[model samples]
Target: MLTPRWILLNRRKLGPITAVAGIVVLVIFLGSAFFSGPSQSQLDKQKSFTTALDNTFASRSFRFEVESKLLGENGFYSKVEGERVMPDKVHIKGTVLKTPVEFTQVNENTYMKDPFSGKWLTLKDIKLSQSELFITELNPLANFNFKDIPEIEMVGEEDLDEDKCYVYELKPNVVNAFLEEQFSDFYYKVWVDQKDVNIRQAIIKANRPESGNSGLDMKIRIWDYDRDLQIDAPVKASTTTQENVPY
Candidate 1:
């Protein structure tokens, strides 16, 4: 009788012990499932969301900062700050080969102020060199189109500044002819805000033709969307005609 009673008591304890062990196993499984990284399907959804945002972003005003570096014997690094308003107005201030250059565009006309001369010249009034013209065309935000990309994929999610963004790696079917002439095998990575669909940051990398496999990289950051920016032409007293400077 004593042996039977002991066995029954042990059986009663085993039930609760097994139940607790089962619950512990279930909690661990649930945690692992919840903490797993995003899947391919999730990445695809993010890519689609970003594509839609890029298509419509230029309709508003924004500010941008660009950091450029050329890797090779003739390597150089420069920083550019730009502001733009919708329709057609832009201002860019930056350095090229350590020389400061500032330019503004309102409608079809562009004005450039020389760093050394401290004088401003209008694009319409002057014969611009290829390099100067190229600088004027550097509108990274408006110049790009989602349709131009051949391949794009979500790399991961990252925090840009204080905003959470989805990072994407992109390869274009063709780059701008002028850019292609200077650099080969170019690629881009962009960070898009998860909440607002705004582009938070972008990076462009390419190999210089003259430097063999040496590369050039440019990091672009966009912010201050729809903020008020006061852009105006240079004062008439400081303006210089094109003929004053030799091209």
Candidate 2:
């Protein structure tokens, strides 16, 4: 066997060049993998949705309203307006089942307004009918409870209360003790403020309950975060008869 000097020399010169070419190809593959799939805009959208969800939960002082409708003959519809202050203070006034209802909670004391008489009463161990409806209504943050944020998208932009807001539609695994029994297929939406990253509004809709009643639809609006909106006792317990309210 005879070794060719020209062929050996060319092999040595091409070896390094082949190595460099392979390195270049590897770099290109890594870059594509890193940059492609789930575009940058999608990542940014998910980040904003998560931030707004966190901000809404951390809020101490905020005014909110929740409007809910159940689609059936026996289904209840309510539009509740409420405000929450840190430590333990909440005032809610709204109509449930076409009856006017109002309640305010401060520390251990709870006050309720009679739907018929329109008089405030101190609640000790009693609750009005369909009181479970007020759970998410009283605290707007309750609706944002998600076990996992699996899908998020920037649907569009909208103006809420004169503030420009970015609207996000998200599919999140929900965990709610209140509606767990009868609801499924939960869909959520949030309207986040552009400047402050505040969740100005949110909507939660679920597939019709198994009871054959129409599904539930809830819309929530939030504002005045951390602002001293002024919550005070509307009436003294002594002034109103004590009602055995158990909540």
Candidate 3:
């Protein structure tokens, strides 16, 4: 539903993510796992579980909704919704620190609309690529990289938007630099498609004693897997792609 004009009018100046990127040394934010036994059934279960995660992460195209909160807070702190088209294109919009943020990316270029001047600016120099730092920053799923995975078990099954899904619970440890110093206890509840092995929904909760009593948590819902889509750059005349960068 977010069109070119809608994004330009709605997005605010970058805040927390921008701060993280500005520091340079501490960016690349974002995070899973399991145990063993003496039985063949256990091994099969583990293999199936790992396979679901692998296939889901391999989802090159999908629409996603990521709602995250700082632990010990009263309500969700960040509510972002977006779509990603494979290779190198993304569109995301939501609020951070209670301020709206929106952007579109195609390859090395990141486009944003200045809240003050209401003008589009293209950051062609930024490398928010899959192989580098900003992958986790833009794609919340990239944060699922786990340094250690705790015991995982099939928790239940459910219907998400009419899609039959298998649900699993995992208490994982991750290295999300964005949350490293401030958050702890990465607990996840994931829903995967019954037939496609693709992830459908996930919720991540972490503790942050400083925020309040609720701590921090994030919920992600993914859909429209691999659907054909077109994500294009803004107009040449209206966007500032070649001028000196102005934030």
Per lDDT, the best of the predicted structures is 2
Q: In candidate 3, what are the lDDT values of residues 1-247, reduced to their tens digit?
A: 6698677655544566567676664432210022333357545555666777787678778888887665543564777788888778888777766877767788878887565576667777553534333343368677678877876777667998888877888888786676666677778888878778777888888887455475766788888888887777767514455355432
Error at 165, model 1, angstroms: 0.2
lDDT of 2 by residue, 123-231 (tens): 5433222256467766667677788877778888898888999998877777777777767777888899988888998888887555555788889988989888676
Which pairs of residues clash in candidate 2, taking residues 3 or more apart in a chain or in different chains?
124-245, 125-244, 125-245, 125-246, 126-244, 126-245, 126-246
**Model 3, runs deviating above 4 Å:** 1-46, 73-76, 128-137, 209-214, 237-247
Candidate 2: where are CA atoms >4 Å away?
1-35, 125-133, 209-213, 238-243
TM-score for predicted model 3 compared with the true structure: 0.71
Q: How accurate locally, in lDDT, is each candidate?
A: 0.71, 0.76, 0.70
lDDT for model 1, please: 0.71
Q: How many residue pairs clash in each candidate?
A: 0, 7, 14
lDDT of 1 by residue, 1-247 (tens): 8999999999999999999999999999888877895667876756665564654464478888878887887787788888877756778888877889787776655688878778877765432322333442346553244346667778888998889888888776443555666777668888887777877788888887676757878888888888888777667525555555545
